[model samples]
Target: MGKIKLTINNRVVEAEDGQTVLEVARENGIHIPTLCYLKDLTGTGACRVCQVEIEGARTLCAACVYPVREGLVVKTHSVRALEARKNVVELIVSNHSKDCLSCIRNTNCELQRLCQELGVREDAYAGNKTPSTFDEVSPGIVRDTSKCVLCGRCVAACKKIQGLGILGFMDRGFKTKVGPVYDRSFNDVNCMQCGQCINVCPVGALHEKEEIHDVINAINDPHKHVIVQT
Candidate 1:
């Protein structure tokens, strides 16, 4: 594709014609917070955290999916854009599980970082939360719906990277969730246990089963032969 010039946050930058606004911004050292946008995965625009203002556009556009065009003008951090992004993060956090203190992905979670960055309040916009499910039936992986942001990253990773298509969005609207078909346990499906979903999950929604206690118990057993392998 031919290179095109676009203005992001009042800064003119040249980018490929088909590149998304988020790509151009990042190439120019501009920061645009995003969720549900993973490199090499198809953009779903499921999360509006990357929304940006476009000149002459009636509504804010998701930078991750909005392709850059010649003379396109974008604002990644305008007051309007920042407020929208902050509100989006707030909604996600309001319904999210409040177990970060003990959650596996606490400090390293993308959602947690976004909350801190956007200054989202712990109790703002609080309302009914989706009924949660904790599925530990899978020996190697755990699925916690309470912390899911519905970002679709794990769904994309499982389908694209693993080609298993074992995971997907189920139900509709407020009742929607991601899981194997018919809400079946991962252990009941043909999952490869490759952990690609875990790798891409933005929150504590998906993680490997915790076995630290089991390992410690084994170590304390006098008759147990535990050989640590790196």
Candidate 2:
């Protein structure tokens, strides 16, 4: 197979034919932010966070799914690309809960980090907020739907990586959410509680329910009997 030569941010690079722009850029140290993109899985291009400017192209292309071609010129940080990335982050923030200070992924959440990086000062868009019912029902995992961005990372992690098929999308546009089959609670499905879904979540939607603070205090009591390494 012939190598496809392309320019990313003014640097020339060669990639094996048929590789997506994102795969080629990643291999060459070009950092492109993504929300719903995952390896070895289907790329839906729904997030629009990985959008980049391709010379002579009428519309911005999603680097995750757009195939690279010979003589293509790509600009990852153009003004138009910046505005699109900022709007995507703002739209996600409008529907998300502003509980980052007390959330488990305060420092590590990808969405939060992107908001800071992109300087998303205001969520100009109106929110389509929906109330959550899983707060008291979820046993092993804490599911805060208010914080969900519908990125589908957890859905892919559950069905593809772990072959669990426990979580998925329910409802339709604007009201769509990643959840267990038939809109059932996580406990209703055959969840293994392996926490793989939680690890891949970019937001605070999925989290461990156990309180580490209480667990640590219980173990520190000298007079009380404590189970070690259980």
lDDT of 1 at 67: 91
- Displacement of residue 85 (Cα, Å) in model 2 is 1.0
Off by over 4 Å in 2: 136-138, 220-223
Candidate 2 per-residue lDDT over residues 25-116, each given as its tens digit: 99999888998888877588879999999999999999999999899999999999999999888888887887989988899898988888
- TM-score for predicted model 1 compared with the true structure: 0.97
Q: Candidate 2 local accuracy as lDDT?
A: 0.85
lDDT of 1 by residue, 168-206 (tens): 999998888998888899999999899999999988999
Count the clashes in each prediction. 0, 0
lDDT of each: 0.91, 0.85
Lowest summed-lDDT stretch of 10 residues in model 1? 115-124
Q: RMSD in Å for candidate 1, one decimal? A: 1.0
Model 1 bad stretches (over 4 Å): none
